[model samples]
Target chain A: MISLNLVLFISSLMFFIGVAGVLIRRNLLIILMSIELMLNAANLNLIAFARQSGTVDGQAFALLVMGFAAAEVAVGLALAVALYRRKDTVQADDINLLNG
Target chain B: MNALFTSIGHNLFLVFGLLACAGAAVMILSTSAVHSVLGFLFSMIMVAACFLCLSAEFLGMAQLLVYAGGIVVLFLFVVMLVELTKYKEKSLFTTQIKWSFPLVLIALGIFAYTMKSNLFDAATPVALSLSSGLAEGLSVSAQNAQMVSRGLFAGFLLPLEILSVILLVALVGALVLAKSERVS
Candidate 1:
């Protein structure tokens, strides 16, 4: 059987990559993509631990996270579209209208 | 043959991990928003595979269904209709890389330390055999799907219903956001 460490390592690496993207990327779409990446990474950790514990709660929670992610992505992308239509550019810097 | 068979599981794990990492990297690095969406799909598929390897059968299937089937389709449709041609390479990666590196490193350091040793200790032989948690007298072995349904729809029924409500709200919000602005 494969060691659990490998699974954790993979998930953590993906999480970091996602974090890096969210921090460094400018395009709104890519930032949304990175957020999905983060969510997926969290799901990976849950499922892995669930496997370790032999409980289904972790997997079930992961499933719930998937549902939440679906809804979040839908709303986020739609807002991006609304903003894009109004402003003609999806650059992150120009989206500072809420800046105080 | 036993050794070879055992080794196959590790191979599958490696394959899934690599696919996930590569897909996530591609998703993050792609210049085009459309390509980024596709990259997310690929990486998510890999994660589903990893879930399967970890015995999270229900999660694996749900990941494919909700994320792959639903979210990516929504993202692609929006990207196709939106004026994504204006998305240029120069603006894709900002000058924020300087700060991102340290933050990522710190997070990774803390996460890695916890995940490494903690999981190792948790994987002690006793924790591996979970014959007690599911049911005592019932002879039926708890499959991943069965245990999950019992846990979520039973123990977590309340949160499940709340999630449905949240999803409904998100649907309404998306519609509201997409509503045509008043023509002055």
Candidate 2:
């Protein structure tokens, strides 16, 4: 069996990479993908701890997270499509309409 | 032969976990949107494999089916739909790259420190005993799907129903948002 600490370490690395991607990337789609990466990293932690503590709640919550991810992607991609249609660009830096 | 297989089994988490991390890195660093989606697909699959390593068979399959099969295809369609060629020559990263890197490093440093402090180690035994009592028939030896189903239905039924409603709302919202305005 893998140690919980090691799994936690891997998840943290993935989460931070996702954070970096969100902060550094200019494209909206990639940012959405980075969010997915972060969610997956959290799911990994949930499953790891679930296994460590011998319960099914973590897996159930992970399923909920997956459902949430799907919904988020659907809405996010739609927004991206809408943005591209109106602005002719998907770059995050370009969408400054709300800036006041 | 038995020892070799056991060793491989023992190290499965390490192998798939690292592969997942590498895939996330690739997704973040890749220049093309298509490449980024592919990298995300790879990372999702590896994470699913890690779930399998942890014996969560149902969650692993869900990850593969939903994330790899559904989400990546959606991303690919959007990538193809949007005009990516014009932006190809432009820089992929934003101006925040300089500061973001250091901030992320600091966040990771805090995470490492917390781990090194062994906060979870002390809580593990208590969690284990409590869960073992709460999980009457949902033992590790039970079928993964069965255990998960029982847990969801028995404990998480309300959330499951609420999630369905949320999915419905998202579907409607997506349709509304992506719909092209009809010419008057």
Q: Write the per-residue lDDT of candidate 1 for residues B105-125, one digit (tens) a residue.
A: 999999988876667655531
Which whole-number lDDT from 0 to 100 does residue B108 have in model 2? Answer: 100
How much is the lDDT of residue B54 in candidate 1?
73
Residue B57 shift from truth in candidate 1, angstroms = 1.5
Interface DockQ of each model: 0.66, 0.67
Off-target runs (Cα >4 Å) in candidate 1 are B1-9, B124-143, B182-184
**Residue pairs with backbone atoms closer than 3 Å in model 2 (clashes):** none
Candidate 2 lDDT over B1-51, as tens digits, reads 999989877798888989998999999999888888989999999999998
lDDT of 2 at A49: 78
